[model samples]
Target chain A: MIEHLPALIIAIPLFGAFIAPLFKKKQSIAAVWAILITAITVILSLMLMYQVRLHGIIVYVFGADKPTIVLPSGYKVPIRIMFEIDGIGAFMAISATLMSFVGALYSYSHVKAESGLEKYYALLLLLEVGILGMVLTGDLFNLFVFLEIAGIAGSALVGFRNYRGEASEAGIKYLIVSAVASLMVLFAIGILYGEYGNLNLAYISRQVSLSTLDMIAFGLLFASFAMKCGSVPMHYWVPDAYTEVPAGINPVLLVSTYASLYALFRVSFTLFANVSISLERVGWIMSVLGVLTMFIGVTMALVQKDVKRLMSYHAISQTGYMLLGVGVGLTVLHNSDALAEFGRTAMAGGIFHIINHIIYKSLLLMTAGALFYVTGTRNLNEMGGLARKMPITTLCFIVGAAAISGLPPFNGFASKFLIYESSYRLNPLLAVFAMVTSILTLASFVKVFASAFLGPPLEKFENVREVPRPMIVAMVILALLCILFGLFPDVVLNKIVYPAVDALINVAQYQSWGGLA
Target chain B: MISKLVTGSGYWSPLLWLAFLILFTLIGYVIYSRGNPSYKKESEQVKPYLSGNAEPSKEKIQVRASDIYWGFIEALKEYYKVLQAIHTGDVRDYILWYLGVGTVILFLLVGGA
Candidate 1:
């Protein structure tokens, strides 16, 4: 049973999604069912994390007598679908599942008054399945399948409020963007398949030759994943999609974006690790995009009147830090001295930021949701003195706001410190841009805090009260995590983040798990 | 002993920062406690001095979100013009950006290859 944790993580959510509609008439039961399933998935994901930490990577092959079998019956190639659970994958799974579980609990009260609770729960569970599958799968085609599943479910959830024209419009735009991006991914996979006659990522990594076609496939995969992850110049869908989603769905959607990011990193460090392509140039590209994303995202966030839209822009800005860190790592991949000097630290910062961002950003978005639930509005200009009514949310918002701004004693600061120190060694300008962005992020959130939560109590909101207990519980869970990760950054880095960085850097080990020498 | 996160070039210890914060906070409290013992809450002396004008409603007094960074936006009006123009909120324009960026990246890769 312990060995089957990988399959159980995916199967539980997928099965839960299928049976979610059975309690259509019983929305309360449906909510509990969704939460229960997600909690189970979260436990299983943590178990998988422990297993991977104790042992090494766990590669589970589908349709095989033993979970360890990658290639069957003396075959040179692995044809069966498989899940390659490395440290990074397990880390992401834990983050994604935990976020989903909180999302489920938050949604229990958030969407209670709304209709179609059954479909909402179903789509939510499916979204988890998609994210989990994408992070865990060893096969490229399986990744595509899960990406579409996430994309479709995400689009539906974004437009879940069909009464709102903006929601429908955002949903359509997200759907189109997701479809085009997925198609590019499929085309790239096809190119790889044509070149090496395999779809398994580990197999392709072992057999890749740096031909012109391989480079094209690499380009497609890179751009598509980058676009999916909301990198700038191609990030127009982010604000629209992120703002329109049901408040409870925002974190899960964000996790899906990180799944795309995970795919991007997997491609760069593992699939194309040995390819003769110019990694420095690719790294420069990512770094440039990172700087641009950080600057533009914060600036746009500065002027937004809508609370969720403001937070959405900040989300994009934060992604830039990750890109910059990992891009620096990629730049120095072949040089062992440089990699040891700062490259690994840079990568570790980026990977650590992924989980940290998920926690704090999700908390911030949920606070926004809580505000909307009570005030019946998302516009910051229309909100004031919310702290008087919603003390828990106010505290959570402060923690989230400070963390996102990279303030000390918070997780964001620790990660950004790593990125800034390492990137400064590479080039001072990169760190300058990062620090400036952090300052602007602080300024933007200060505006939000003052406009929405501070000032004298308003007459119109005299009756406004705190959100439901479940919502408070959800937000508190994330807030505690933010403080915990902040106060004890070393514990998180040593226990969780370093192993992921090590797993990512060890391309030989990744390939070996796939039966490659 | 609190663990320090050593990042090749430098290190950070949250415990040390916390200790410094606690020390400064205590110092601030001691200084604060030395002043304003006679001050009273909910008194006429504590009310806002509006230059002999009547105080307005709380909502009217509060600054709106749009007004938070008026000077910053005004100073960067030219930059914001181009930025806002690019964000036309049209799905067609977004797709165009996607294609445009994707094409550029593709050219770079294939050309370099």
Candidate 2:
């Protein structure tokens, strides 16, 4: 049973999504059922994490007589579907499942009054399945399948409030963009299949020769995944989609974007690890994109009046720090001295930022949702003096805001500190841009705190109260994690993040699981 | 200790920072406690004073969200103009940017290869 935990994690959510609609009339039961299903998936994902930690990497072949049989009988390479759960995959799985669990909990009270409770919960579960599959699957074609599932479910949920024209419009835009990106992914997969005749990532990582077609495929995969992850100047759809997504499930949707980011890193570090691809050139490109993403995201966020839209732009901006950090690592990939000096730390900073970003970003979005729940609006201009009415939500918002701003005693600062220290060694300008972006991020959140939470209490909100206990619980879970990760950065780095970075840079271990080495 | 993170160039210890923060906070509190006792909340001294002029309504005095960064926006008007213009919020334009970026990446990779 433990050996099959990888398959069970995905299968449980897939099955739960199908049966969720059965409790259509029983909305309360439906909420409980959804929470229970997500909770079970979270537990299974944790079990899988522990297994991977105990046994290095777990390769579960779907059609083989035994789960460990990567090459059956006479076959030279793995032709069957398989899950390759390494350190990073396990790390992302934990993040995705934990986020889905929290989102489910928050949705119980946030959307209970809305109609279509059944489909809403179903789509939420499907979204989780999609994210889990994307992070866990080893086959390239399987990744494409999961990407589509997540894209479709995420798009549907974005447009779930169909009565509002903006919601429907945002949903349609998201669907079209997702379809195009997924098609590009499929095309790239087809290119790889044509060249190597195998869809397994580990197998292909061993077989790739860096041909012209391979370069084209790598380009397509890089651009498409980067776009999916909401990097600028290709990030136009992010604010529109995120601003309109139901605040309850917004964090999960953000996790889906990170899944795409995982794919991007997988393609760069794992798929092309052995090839003599121009590491410096590629790294520079990524660093440039990171700088642009951070600067533009914050500038746009600073001018926004809508609460969620501002955060969405900040989401794009924060992604820049990750890119810059990891890009610095990639730049020094071949130089062991530079890699040891600053490159590994930079990558660690970037990787560590991913988990930290999800925690504080989720807390921030939930607080935004709580504000919307009470005020019936998302416009910051329409809000004032909420600190007096909803003290708990205000405190959560301050934690999230301070964290995202890279203030001390919060998770965001720890990751940004790593990024700043390492990126500065590569180029002073990179670190300077990062620091400027942090300042701008602080300014943007200050705008939100002042305009939305502070000031004299508005007459209309005199009767407003704190959000429900469940929403508070969800936010508190993430808020505490923010502080925990901040205060004890080395524990998380040594236990979780370093293993992931090692898994990415060390291609032999990934290939060994598939008998490719 | 697990609380200390040593980057290649430097180190960060949030626990140490917290300890200093607590110490300073306590010191600040002691100083605050010895300050003027005449200051009181919900008193006439707490009311808004507009340079000895009549005070405006609460709604009028409070700065709105858009007005918070008026000068900053004005300072970067040229930059914002280009940014806002590019972000037309059109799906067609979004696709164009995607294709444009894709073409550049393809060129760079193939050229480098």
Candidate 3:
């Protein structure tokens, strides 16, 4: 089971995705099949986490007994494709699949009356497969392949309802940006492959010299991945796409965004670990990007009237926290003792926020989906007094709002507290900016809550009811996790988050897992 | 029963905070919930006040969502103008921004190298 788990994780979804269209005749069946595929993928991800704990850093090379780092003829590095599952990969995998599964479950009711049901679930599974592959694959070129698959699938999903308002426009925008980004990533890979003569990441890392071209390649990869993750100046497409897509699909898209962020970290920490560039300077550059993203996202969110668009901007803002945490980690990369003192905590804060943000952000979006499900509109002015009609959705939204705002005793505050306190140790201004962003985030959500949910009931929505049970169940699960994780920060900190941070910093363990040493 | 999650550099224990929050919340909820009924619903008491003129319909009287944060938006007008200009909603401009950043990064990083 351990030997075949990697292949199975990707294969189940890849095969199941194609089969999803077959059940088009029965749309309900298609939805069920999607749920099953995603559920199994989630379980497999959990199992991989357990297996990695029992036996550290499980390496499953494709078509070989060993990692195949040493070719029988002569070469001295890994040549075959491989899947490396460590604590970080498992954390992301489980988060992605778990969210994807929940998104599918919610999609059933949300898209039931809409057309293109079959294509919707198919793209859903394929998107998850792409994200899973991107995180789990050990080969650099293979990572690019997964990145393309995700990019394409994500673009199509963004325009699932192409005939509707601005959906097609958003899709085209996303496609063009993705094409440009992918080309940049591809050119970067070409440079690396030309320099090192290897496509495997661990192999390339061992042999890569910090030539001028290599530095250029790293810069290209950084810009492209940062754009893919919706950083500022590169984030204009985010609000358009998030608002246009079927609300059920937004959560899965959020997971994919995290996958791109994971790529950014992996490329910098592992791929360029031994490079000759001033990592601390690079870290400062990334820190500037983080601060800009946080401020711009919240300010733009303040002026938006559409509910989904408003939350979409917040998603970009939340990405800033993760970037900031990791940026601090990189800024202090030189001193191992200092890194252990605060850098690890910063990485842990960033990675932990990835987990927290996914839960609360998706829950908030699904509540927005439920609003659209009944209200038939995404505009905030048109929605009023919903709390009286749909109590469950209201409750879920409150939990999500409180969490996203970093109110104490929720998951957001726990991760953010780590980021705030640790980053203050590095630079007080970064912490100050982060805290201001948090306050602005709260203010923005309050506006949404007041205008959209808590106002006097609109006459048209007199009969509004709670969302379907499956949708509510999905939201309840996320909400429960938010509260639980918040209450027991120490448990999550010790058990899941700190381990992933350790895996990230320990590039040697990753290289040895590839059998490069 | 307060326990601390001391990570050496940072600590975030929700125990004391949670206790304080629950205490204040209960006190607030009790005071707010104790209010007696002083007015009738669907009566003249429920009518909107509009400086002695007849009240407009709810939709007409209600504030636009965008208007809610008008002051903040105005204060950040210069910043927003630059931002909104960059987000021109045109595909060509979007690509330009993407390339423009790519070029900047290429120079910034390669120059350092």
Question: TM-score, each model?
Answer: 0.98, 0.98, 0.96
TM-score for candidate 3, please give it.
Answer: 0.96
Provide the DockQ value for model 2: 0.84
What lDDT score is found at residue B69 in candidate 1? 91
Candidate 1: Cα lDDT at A34:
94
Better of 2 and 3 by TM-score: 2
Report lDDT (Cα) of residue A446, candidate 2.
96
Q: What is the interface RMSD of each candidate, in Å?
A: 1.0, 0.9, 1.9
Q: Give the per-residue lDDT of model 2 (tens digit) for A56-120.
A: 88898898898888888878888999999999999999899999999999999999889998999
Q: Cα deviation of A412 in candidate 3 (Å)?
A: 0.8
Give me the chain B TM-score of candidate 3: 0.74
The residue-level lDDT of candidate 1 at A393 comes to 95
* Candidate 3: tens digits of C-alpha lDDT, residues B1-113: 45555656646678888888899999999998898867678767766773677876666755657778889889989999987777788888777777888788778777777
lDDT of 3 at A32: 94
Encode model 3's per-residue lDDT on A122-190: one tens digit a residue: 999999999999999888888989998998999999989977859988988888888888898999999
Q: Pairs clashing in candidate 1?
A: none
Show model 3 residue runs off by greater than 4 Å. Answer: A66-75, A514-517, B1-4, B30-44, B50-55
Record all residue pairs in model 3 with backbone atoms less than 3 Å apart, i.e. clashing. A69-A77, A69-A78
